[model samples]
Target: MSRKRLYLRAGLYAEGRSDYDFLLPLLNRLLSSLASSLFPGACDVEDSLGIDAPYPAPSERAERIAAAIADRRAECTLFVIHADGAGDPRYARQSCLDPGIDAARRASPDVVTVPCVPVRETEAWLLVDAEVFRPWLGSDAHSALPAEPEREADPKLTLGRLLKVKEGRMRRKPERLYRLFGEEVSLEALRALPAFQLFEAELVEAIRAVARSQGWPR
Candidate 1:
């Protein structure tokens, strides 16, 4: 049986971390779980961001990622997932998603660019496989990390019904208060919040769509 190699790029902020650190693990868990659950012999997914190199420009980033996909030398598909609408000059001046898709198509024409709905919405994608990652929170998931939150309330209140309860009850919901709290909240915020369940479901469906398009190996 010929094995296809799948390559993924986690984008700029994810550079120096091990797969166990951040988004990589979340994505890996989803893909591996899906593959194991549905297809025992599907293509093996590998991340090439481990190359220990400087961050490339948008086009260069696409090229470098494309080169890695090409080097796999197997019938494969490459998916590049990134955060869009970050107010980055490059993404604003030129379409990062389009160029990436074009670059990957240069190799397989099947390459996919799965940009987050928006920069802020990236929290949704990062948390797509969060259920499997709660253990990493260690002890209290709420206090996994401490910050000087602008709001006096426990930051975890941002999670779901609590958010409504806290903000809705506030006599004066300060704009700065909400914005500052948002900055401190991690991707875990989405996982713990009920409002984002739909986003998480969308990510799972998108991933499954890609996998299915690739022809899941039975």
Candidate 2:
């Protein structure tokens, strides 16, 4: 197979550390997954704000990114972002969704942007992949996981509760989820989630369009 390479400049602005961390590795894996099979080759991501870098304020993120990209302060031809939908998807987009999209476009008219919101929380993506969670929750607590995770009001709460259940106690620690989703979860399983689907579709199409514009063959 002939592989095409995109000198991609990726920019990311996320709501929190966990999502920031989860978003980077997950995105790399996802890009690789899509590239090797779906497209011609690989997308090498370049972002001045490293994948593990700190995030800007949610409100100013779009404005900052637009300025950065325009000035080459942040170098990326494309931007991938993650911000919580927080209990309302409506507010989530207003806060960052439209702005992020607009900023990337303004920065580089052709730059492709994919901004993701986890509905209520990023933890919800983990639940879409049952097999991954089935192991983490163990056999005993496996039954406790929801069949339709997106329906749960606070999937993050369910994740925390499930972890606590495994240890035979309840605790409000967010680090556990941070570790589980960051370290052990599978991206392939995450493909089942609607959020992931939106991300994947947008990202793939962006690459394809960019490739066509750059005249790269698949």
Candidate 3:
């Protein structure tokens, strides 16, 4: 029998430019991890941001998803959309993500869609592991980190304050910090979060579907 190698290509539709910086690396890692677990043989995972096409208006989320699918359908096996829960995870999923996913699938039947709705904001997920950013804080700053970041009304603001303290009056840009968090934050800590777990489950199912279609044994 000829050896089979699985090659997975993923595309991302991030909510913001900074979101791409964070989510691209994070998605790549997550997909690689999941692919390795599901495929015993050699596996390769590659990802790209769906930036070839312009996004529609923020309110036209379903259109945006359809556009992304149209743009990357040929090159990508899976498409992940990142949307901040913005204080109401259920509403975000029901009002924004589900409609978008449905439209994308309807428009491009071959496209595999995955929703990544981080509760409150993507920053909340970054806070899952304080150790990732603790070293950047000043010694005098002694404020306790939020015990439940998803419940925090504005995790981005909280993270901004910490980064400001670390950089003093210079006002550090958060994009680098987000990238750092994406690279180093512990997957175990993220898995403990309900929102992350939901994403993982959906992502795994999508990958399984792709594998089945490709005639790969799961």
Best by lDDT: 3
**lDDT per residue, candidate 3, 1-218, as tens digits?**
96777778888887787788788888888888999998856677876555434544445767777776777787888888888998887888888778878887788776787888988899888777767666765453334567777888898888776666533542445677677777887888889889999999999999988887778875
The CA root-mean-square deviation of candidate 3, after full C-alpha superposition on the true structure, stands at 2.7
CA lDDT for candidate 3: 0.78
Q: Tens-digit lDDT track for model 2 on 56-157?
A: 423466665555445443455556666777777668878866875686576567766676777788878766554555654556444666877767898878
The Cα local distance difference test for each model comes to 0.40, 0.63, 0.78
Q: Enumerate residue pairs that collide in model 3.
A: none
- Roughly what TM-score does model 3 have, to 2 decimal places? 0.88
Q: TM-score, each model?
A: 0.42, 0.74, 0.88
Error of 3 at 106 (Å): 1.8
Clashes counted in candidate 3 amount to 0
Residue 183 CA displacement from its true place in model 1, Å = 22
Task: Enumerate residue pairs that collide in model 1.
Answer: none
Which candidate comes out best when scored by TM-score?
3
